[model samples]
Target: MANTTSAKKATRKIARKTAINKARRTRVRGCLRKVEEAIAAADQAAASEALRIAQSELMRAVSKGVFHKNTASRKVSRLSKRIKALSA
Candidate 1:
């Protein structure tokens, strides 16, 4: 239990932030899943488009601090590489 008023306020704030972060994380995961599904289907065009949207969502999550910058970059790199491989 929070002993001070400040502690209670901080707890509330943390809860709110946690909920927001969870939502952002869920959305990012959904975007990644979409890209993977497109790639698995072997549809280069759809994969490319999904990758584009996923990249944007990933970077946005990074900007919001939901994901580390390097993590987002790595994901985008791997996805792009896969998409390129599909074309080749």
Candidate 2:
């Protein structure tokens, strides 16, 4: 339990931030799932489009501190490679 007023305020702030972070993470996951679904269906066009949207969502998460830059880059790289393979 937070004994001090400032500590209570800090706890509230953390909870709000946590909620925002969770929402951002969820959004990123949903975008990635869309890409994965397109890939699994072997639809090159849909996969390409999904990857585009996922990439943007991923970078946004990175900028918001929900994901590390390298983690986002790695995800984008793997998804792009998979999309390219679908076309090939």
Candidate 3:
């Protein structure tokens, strides 16, 4: 659907970026799932570690423009609260 030369090149770049962004999102989701599972299993230590990892991944997503900064912050806040509640 791209007609101009630069448009065609931009389209290609967009496709590549889409793959990278998708992978980043998948990894973030996996990290979050790990945290959730650890919390569900009542493993406080593991849940804390997993939360750290998931938070890092979410921040990375924000830096890469895959997520908004506020969105990542909100998720991190909620996840941290859940992890804290597991201990309390």
Candidate 4:
């Protein structure tokens, strides 16, 4: 229900941005899941590697505004802590 031409254009732009953001969110979640799976399996090496990749992807998502900076940091921190605990 975009009445004006500009409104229609804005809607289109929003749709494109929504798609991109959704993809980024999915990617970040996938990365986090990989880390969690590794942790659950108690594989220290795999968990460590997955955490590294997840941290990178999470930070990237933060940069893209898919997640807040502190949110990403907290997730990374908690996951790293879990990974450390795996070694103990």
Give the Å shift of residue 30 in candidate 1: 0.4
Write model 3 residue lDDT over 1-88, tens digit each, in one string.
9999999999999999999999999999999999989989989999999998999999999999999999999988998888889877
TM-scores of the candidates in the order shown: 0.97, 0.97, 0.94, 0.97
- For candidate 2, the TM-score is 0.97
Give one digit per residue, the lDDT tens place, for model 4 in 47-72: 99988999999888888899999999
For each candidate, the alpha-carbon lDDT, in order, equals 0.93, 0.94, 0.94, 0.93
Evaluated against the true structure, the overall lDDT of model 4 is: 0.93
Model 2 agreement with the true structure over 1-88: per-residue lDDT tens digits: 9999999999999999999999999999999999999999999999899889989999999999999999999999998998889877
What's model 3's overall lDDT? Answer: 0.94
Q: Write the number of the candidate with greater lDDT, choosing between 1 and 2.
A: 2
Instruction: Give the lowest summed-lDDT range of ten residues in model 3.
Output: 79-88
Q: Which pairs of residues collide in model 2? A: none
Prediction 3 TM-score vs. true: 0.94
The global Cα lDDT (0 to 1) of model 1 is 0.93
Residue 45's lDDT in candidate 1? 96
